[model samples]
Target: MADPVHKKTEPNGRYLIALSVAALGVVFGDIGTSPLYAVREAFGEHYGLALTEANVLGVLSLIFWSLIVVISLKYLTLVMRADNHGEGGIMALTALVMPSKLRRGHWRYLAVMLGLFGASLLYGDGMITPAISVLSAVEGLEVAAPRLEPFVIPVTVGILLALFLFQSRGTQRVGGLFGPVTLVWFSAIALLGLAQIVRNPYVLTALNPYHAVHFFTANGATGFWVLGSVFLVVTGGEALYADMGHFGRTPIRLTWFFVVLPALLLNYFGQGALLLANPAAVENPFYLMVPGWATYPMIALATAATIIASQAVISGSFSLTRQAMRLGFLPRMTVVQTSSQEIGQVYIPTINWILMFATVGLVLGFRSSSRLAAAYGVGVTTDMVFTTLLFAVVAWSLWKWPRWAVVLLTLGLLGVDLSFWAANIVKVPQGGWFPLVVGAVMLVVMTTWHQGRALLSSVLQKDAFPLERFLETLAASKNPPVRVPGTAVYLTRNADVVPPALLSNLRYNRAVHENVIVVSVETEEIPRVLGSLRAEVRALDLGFTRVVLHYGFMEHPNVPVALYDITELDLDPDDTYFVLGREIVLPEGKLGMPRWREQLFAVLQRNALPATAFFDLPPAQTFEVGHLVRL
Candidate 1:
């Protein structure tokens, strides 16, 4: 195979812009769209009781403060630094601190469980995001025209269908428009709020910490309910870490601090002002913030922003699916690259179809954004809570920060996270069951796949020959004459020993080959290893030796790039012939785990692609030798 996987780079500036737009468009839009629903949900239905002026001010203050604490401080400023080899997201964070790759067996088992739980939480978020964002936006239609009330749910479904239909085309065409439009959308948010703040200048009092404390402490049992409301402000906060690779830590931080944070706070305070002036209109206060002349247009803009929010969650599901496949948490999935230059521009049809189905179910089942709002906070909040604990481990153990500082920060942060988590816990009987069910299914799938792989290692122990014996056999064969001058390699999965494929090839050909390389893919927890230590090529007699290929989880294994730099190979790409090993993944007659759970692994594996396909290696240059193991 010449090379299908080794991709060439496109112009840098263009890719950067597209990435930025996508990040802001669908990626960052979730939190941005919260102004549409978060306030009303907090006071009107799910948790809090009355939409009084004091409650409105208190809730608005909490949202603002939560944004400052969670998004601005915890994630944007802090958690981003813990990125492993430029890879962000919960999986990467876990790998950074949990020692997932280093420890095997039961320890490796638990780390995978925690990481998968976090990841499963994300998938649950993916299912809920499109439903809530689109429903909320379409509900604005009712606000603009009361007669459209009866058709809100149906209209939302149509819009969601149109959104997924557009996925195949990729975001390149419409993405450019997203940036300038998001810029306008954000400005309108601030400007509309500015007018309201001018009228009720006292609404600015919500910015003070005292209002937040007073609302929670002084206000009887109602204060406890604000926990559900608090979740709204922090909804899309996790996207900050998930999209870290798209726009380095610097840009996202800037976007959050300078652009996103300010626009959201002002708009929220404005909503508070509007509610204070006319408490009866609390049902659709976001729309009512504008004058009658601007109400319809504001609804239009809100609808557009909500669609972008849904798009982000859809795209994130694809990326997370791919990562899980790579780490062997999930099975290999067929991935189609939609854009030539953008690495993030991928579409998985299976994930897409499932998401569309579930989202449609969610839309119709809930009927309105208000109903869906009941289900939304629990997932996002739980995810944040998981991320918080992971960060605590990182600060003390991974980063080696001062213990006192880490302890104090962890307590303060976890307290807020736990408080929100506990309140959402009350929703378990309500809409919370949706995410819990999603999480349970995902956990079962991830756990079974991991355990089943370990059983493979145990069963194959007898079949796998020791590394020294195979090496000595090649040495013994050099007596006559070895065939081939350049390096002929065996792409072994384990570098610690010679692979059965290498031994088999020699026995069949009845000849010793020159420069036989046993290359194994070794993964590191901290991601990319420095280029200084590419390959440890040893000179063994008869040209048979070891060449271990090391890759940090942060970097992809590029065989061509790696081999080109090997001076012993004369730095020639064509001179080296590549061989890849394949194994039949089968269950032993004895049930390794439980029977039903083993079935779960089978389901996940059927959905996954082969290991070779994911590494971006060409098929022609690779050869497969099937080996069987009995337990």
Candidate 2:
């Protein structure tokens, strides 16, 4: 079947330019803000690298090529092409490679685990990005006035607090400003670097790959270790692909290559020039490169940019949460539509508060951006590795590319990802374990939720009979219950199985609605389902109608809105009853997952948002019947 989401056409010229500018903020914020600290951290005292011209050149060379190869070549040119329909992200890519229905202990399980673990790692990234980015920006105070150094951490925590609090208000108001502000930021930083580069034009020579090679040849083990810090330059490269759905591929690539990449190169090389000219400036190369008078203004600008970066990551976490929930990897949570104008702008209070506390704690615990930097990179690098592996699967299995071609592409990209990952692994002892631990915990939660649901389906299936058989049996009954006037919609997971709510209602109230509808929502692998293919309707016997509503993983399942369009059912808002089943999980089962996992699953199930809210059912007319089931 032809996919509905992926379109070959590009946006019009005017829209393209606008999107590219918008992409500057959402897509490039994290990587764009890296200039505040990437160079400073690379040459920090922690790496033990000297402030010599050759070392400066070498680091610049590595940073430049990393942006070129990883971001420009790998992500934009290749990985972005592996997008699931028009959507791209580790989770979307995972959905692309995943089987329509996952079977327990399947061979493709390895890919599923890799993709999920990668997606899980982003949560860690979400937590750390805000802490490090904001702290790094605020730390510029030390350069402006040495006296203000003591207040940096407190200021950072305060800023993060305000940012999280503002999430409830949504981004529609501030979102327009992000692009223009970020554009100004990029232009200002570019000019700053240009001024420095003109003074020491030789730093531009680091553009040659030989300097990167020579740095490794000279520093040996220490140079290799320095990559952990250098990797920071391209840390947000994945955002380009992840946000591709919001902005098209052309706009993201256009923004990256034309705007973001040049600005980054100039700034990084300019920082290298500053370091070469004045070794003492290594303490804070990014801010030191700024004019003494512009220091405070620059600090504010950097802070704004970092805040934008943090916003993108936080928003991404919310988006990933929604996708995970739709894909059955997560339990449903309350998702607030933050903007009436934008469907993508959603706010999840649960996610926002959790991230807020974690980010604030990180700022307090680390006390400095440099320390927080040590805890970063591992999760992102590992996620990159998983993305590459999943991309390989897409190339080979989905796209039907030759095995040899896939192998070459995978090997080349994996080399860069694995090397960075190995460099980052050394940081595990120095607080890098934070993201790993977070990813592990998340993986446990996600896998447990998925497995538990599977088991629940199995048990429910055992008790359910075919819809046709149930209808025929009811019709054959000696005395059928009196038909009710209102239309009844019973929501269930399987259309073939009898709805538990229907069973409970019949066993107790002993009455069937005159018009009965069994509705099952199916989340498709693609990002969206077109209106033409949204619903599949089948008329059954004895006043029974089976309706299956199809939604993409990226979409929210709104039962009432979808059912309203059917026309034939003539669903009424006032008279219709939306019957839902509430499963009360009993974790004391000998079969299925371990007892501990079952307990966790039970807790997750119990806390999940009600179907009435998640499916957009009218609460006034919605009612849930409870059923107990062993895991």
State the C-alpha lDDT per candidate: 0.73, 0.90
Cα lDDT tens digits for candidate 1, 1-631? 1111222232246665555554576547888888888777777654546767667778877888889888889888888877766778988886765563333466544555666788887888888888988788777777778898888888888988998888888887776677667767888998888888899989887878877787887776668776786788888888889888767766677667777888988888988888888886688778878788887787778778878777788889888776665565666666878877776778888889988888899988877777777687787777887787777676776577898998899889889888888877777776888887888888777667767766765555557776767667645754644476665667776766667776667667665456677777665554456676656776665566677776654445666667668877663455666666555545454645776776665555555665556655556666666665433
RMSD of 1: 4.8
Residue-wise lDDT of candidate 2 within 434-497, one digit each (tens)? Answer: 9999999999999999988988888898888888988888999998988999899999999877
Candidate 2's displacement at residue 529, Å, is 1.1
Model 1 worst lDDT run, 10 consecutive residues:
1-10
> What is the Cα-based TM-score of model 1?
0.87
**Every model's TM-score:** 0.87, 0.98
- Which runs in model 2 stand beyond 4 Å of their true positions? 1-8, 100-105
What local lDDT does model 2 show for residue 311? 96
